[model samples]
Target: VVYYFQARGHGDYDSDFSDEESGEKSVQKTKSVKEDDLLRKPFQKAKQGSVVHRRFAAEEWDREEARKRRFHLISMDAYQRHKKFVNDYILYYGGKMEDFRRSGENDKTDLDVIRENHRFLWNEDDEADMNWYKRLAKKYYDKLFKEYCIADLSRYKENKFGFRWRHEKEVISGKGQFSCGNKHCDEKEGLKSWEVNFGYVEHGEKKNALVKLRVCPECSYKLNFHHR
Candidate 1:
């Protein structure tokens, strides 16, 4: 059953998911998730419309833009043979072959690019904190290999760019082009990720924006509940 989770503030601990279809089916639960200083400390400084939030958001906008512009799609063959967690593509900043810092094969994956090249890639943070970031980055990337990067065989090869599973021989145009438009997902290819128009908002003076997103599959399932 598809459900929507209501975010409860930290430390209070009550979290719940309400079934979209039944409306009466609501499950209340507590999450054991531990938050770090970002949630407790930095978050205070990063308040909406504050100087801190604006500063990081602007820098993040630029860095994310650069990552997409520099993306180099690795062949499917490389992804399959990967001993570690696989990625959609790699990043190259200089836009040239020799700029790769790795020795021998000069091979570096998106997995390591951020940590190794943080000074260049991450512009928002102060330079003095980069060393701490480097250590943190290492642990995070190692965890990435274990956690979020797992290749789900069920969801595998569904063609992340709005394509059907390979088994379907015939398919209609504009059919399976999006996963979900409800919540945000992090596949790391941010600039042109699969975006399906969710809805529209009317602005008094400015043009209306058609909301679009690439969200997790569970959220995607909610879209079909009403149709059934």
Candidate 2:
């Protein structure tokens, strides 16, 4: 009716059966025990003090600070040009530039007031002029970025900041944002584009892994094997 066969090791067994009418013989495969389970060994999380984690974390922080500083400087430069244009337009239209300034507030508010009153000073020909200025400003910004911010990669080789160089290159080359490598995942709605390295740690040492890929935040979570 039924037969049982013992496997070679402990907690291992198999079953054999026969149909009475057709006389067909069948064997049911037993689930094999993994070596890890047998040895009671489990994967351990990386410790906070681990060299790999600490090194990467510090690099990431530095890269972020650098990026912020770069953006702040560029924005200030752009704002200055914008302010000069606004002042010239207001003076040409017989209006005092100082009249638009908000008392005790920052230069940003002044820029905002000028923008709100743009229609009063800007005409069709001035639109073309503004476009020219914008183009010139963008070229200047790009030149500065490539010369200063991206001249060195040694500062961010091991962290997410290294991706900035690649991103900047792509932007300069007109490539825009690269698609996330995952085909089935469509989770890039509001997440910033990131170049992520996929790798593993073994015996307290991080193994250098494959090429970095462009990925959205959701796909990154899966690639990193994050549990949460």
Candidate 3:
């Protein structure tokens, strides 16, 4: 077969190249020409233009990036400030409890003192501010205690812990009232009435390890840490 094909091609030089090779060469040449054209076209267009548009686009992109960075910085600053606020508030309440002790209220249970202090911190209009406080507390506490590992509750085991609490403050008269707070059931509805939610704290450990003296429920959820 080799001899036969070699003879057919006449003297081993492929005097008449096969159609396939010819077609392949033609494709290669066309591809090279197209690529060269593509390369040159971009340069030609760029040369025709003053590069002003490209510079403007680059500058705009930089400005947009800078604006995004500024927003991020501001958000981070706000978060840090809020964290300090929560820490200070907790410390203030703890200090207030010291006052109670000095005033001969040392016989009061830790829970009792915490409850009393929380009541003192609250006003009738406190309900309106509860949600905002909740959000701020979650954000800052999560960052300090979870992400930055700044606050080790185990270190301050005996420190007073507080919470923005929502309890079963008596089921609504007649049918129960459900707030739209349930995520799983958006359409869930029931009898409606305002439930009193107040902020409270406890000194020392709670049964739930997550809700123990180390961290509050709101911060636990924010940090995605298991409570108990």
Question: How many pairs of residues collide in each model?
Answer: 0, 0, 2
Instruction: Indicate whether candidate 2 or candidate 3 has the larger lDDT.
Output: 2
Rate residue 4 of model 2 by lDDT.
72
Best prediction by lDDT: 2
Worst 10 residues of 2 by lDDT: 144-153
Inter-residue clash pairs, candidate 2: none
Full-model lDDT, candidate 2: 0.45
* Per-model TM against the reference: 0.14, 0.16, 0.17
Candidate order by decreasing TM-score: 3, 2, 1
Cα lDDT over the full model 3: 0.41
Model 2, C-alpha of 183: deviation from truth (Å): 3.2
Best-first order by lDDT: 2, 3, 1
lDDT of 2 by residue, 111-223 (tens): 45443333311235535655544444333333432211111123222332222223355445433234343434334354344334434443354544323344567555654
lDDT of 1 by residue, 1-228 (tens): 997766664544543442343344322111222433425764365345645577788999999987775453343355454522222223322343344345767666655565354321122443455565465554443332110111122332342322212112111221122322222333322222233322222222222222333335554443333434
- RMSD values for the candidates in order, in angstroms, are 44.0, 39.8, 26.9
